[model samples]
Target: MKFRKATKKDVQAIVEMIADDALGKTRENFQTPLPKAYYNAFENINNDNNQELIIVENENAEIIGTLQLSFIQYLTYKGGIRAQIEAVRIKRDKRGTGLGTKMFEWAIKRAKERSAHVLQLTTDKKRPEAIVFYEKLGFVASHEGMKMHFS
Candidate 1:
């Protein structure tokens, strides 16, 4: 297994995995010749030094997982850098194979390498299993998260 920064060619695979879930079915517009918005977002993320779009490949070099990490600089924590993980997705066939745990462990190590003071992530309350998995990995539900989505 190998974890590396994603390139433009990897977007389709990333989106495929991300859109393969119940919640994703509602929010993601995954299709052949994907919408330009996806590419735009990828370009923005790729150009940002604080952002990392990661892809995981198996021994055969097939993309099986993806996640985005954002380094946020804020005054809160006395000017600290918080590494936020989001959009984690593993191919349906690869779920429940311990790859998720290893991917997260790699993310934690990557955060430390980037000199982040803390690592954080938010999963939808509807994903109970994900919450449990995160908890098992030593994450605590310390604060209530609220979001306002715009149409």
Candidate 2:
């Protein structure tokens, strides 16, 4: 497998992978006509120097996974910078194959190279398995995370 920065052409595959999941089915729309919002968001991410949308492909050049990493400059934590990882999705068939682990490893390395003092992510509480998976990767449930959806 090879990991690379995602291009506009990869967005469709990434959206499909995202929509393949249970929760995503309720929140994501990856159908005919697709959504302009996805492309709009992709463009914003692509143009930002502090953010990256990554794509993972196999030997046949089929996209198998994707994730986004963002570096945030902050005044707290001794003026440290932090890396926030999100939108991690692997093709259903690619799960349990250490691909997610490999993705995290790559994210960590990239975060360190960017001089980030911390790496963080928030997973849905409904995904118990994901919590375990992240715990195994050295992430701790140190604080409660909350969000409010305007929609």
Candidate 3:
């Protein structure tokens, strides 16, 4: 598998992978004539130096996994920077093949290279398996996370 920063052209494939899962099928709108919001968001992420949308592809050049990393410089923790991992998704067919582990490993490496003091991510509580996977990767449930959606 190969990993690279995502381009605008990769947005569709990434969205499709995201929508393939049960939860995503309920939330993502991957219908005929894709939504402009996806492209708009992609452009926004691509323009931000602190944010990265990554794509992982197989030898066949098919995009099979994706994730986003955002580096935030904050005043807390002795003015340390934190790397936030988000939108981690892998194609359903590719889930059990060690690709997810590799992806997290890569993210951790990148975060350390960026001099981030911490790497963190929030997974939906509904995905118990994902929580276990993250714990295996050395993440802890240290704090409660709450969000209020406005849409």
Q: What are the C-alpha RMSDs, in order, of all predicted structures?
A: 0.7, 0.8, 0.9
Candidate lDDT (C-alpha), each: 0.95, 0.94, 0.94
lDDT of 3 by residue, 87-146 (tens): 999998898999999999999999999999999999998899999999999999999999
Query: Which candidate order results from sorting by lDDT in descending order?
Result: 1, 3, 2
The global Cα lDDT (0 to 1) of model 1 is 0.95
**lDDT, candidate 2, 1-151, per-residue tens:** 8999999888889999989978999999999667999999999999999999999998999899999999999899888999999999999998999999999999999999999988999999899999999999999898899999997
Q: What is the lDDT of candidate 2?
A: 0.94
Query: Which residue segments of model 1 deviate by more than 4 Å?
Result: none
13: Cα error in model 3, Å? 0.5
Model 3 vs truth, CA RMSD: 0.9
lDDT of candidate 2 at residue 43, scale 0 to 100:
97
Better of 1 and 3 by TM-score: 1
- Model 1 TM-score on a 0 to 1 scale: 0.98
Q: Give the number of the best model, judged by TM-score.
A: 1
lDDT of 1 by residue, 1-151 (tens): 9999999999999899989999998899999999999999999999999999999999999998999999999898888899999999999999999999999999999999998988899999899999999999999999999999898
With a 3 Å backbone cut-off (N, CA, C), the pairs that clash in candidate 2 are: none
**Per-model TM against the reference:** 0.98, 0.97, 0.97
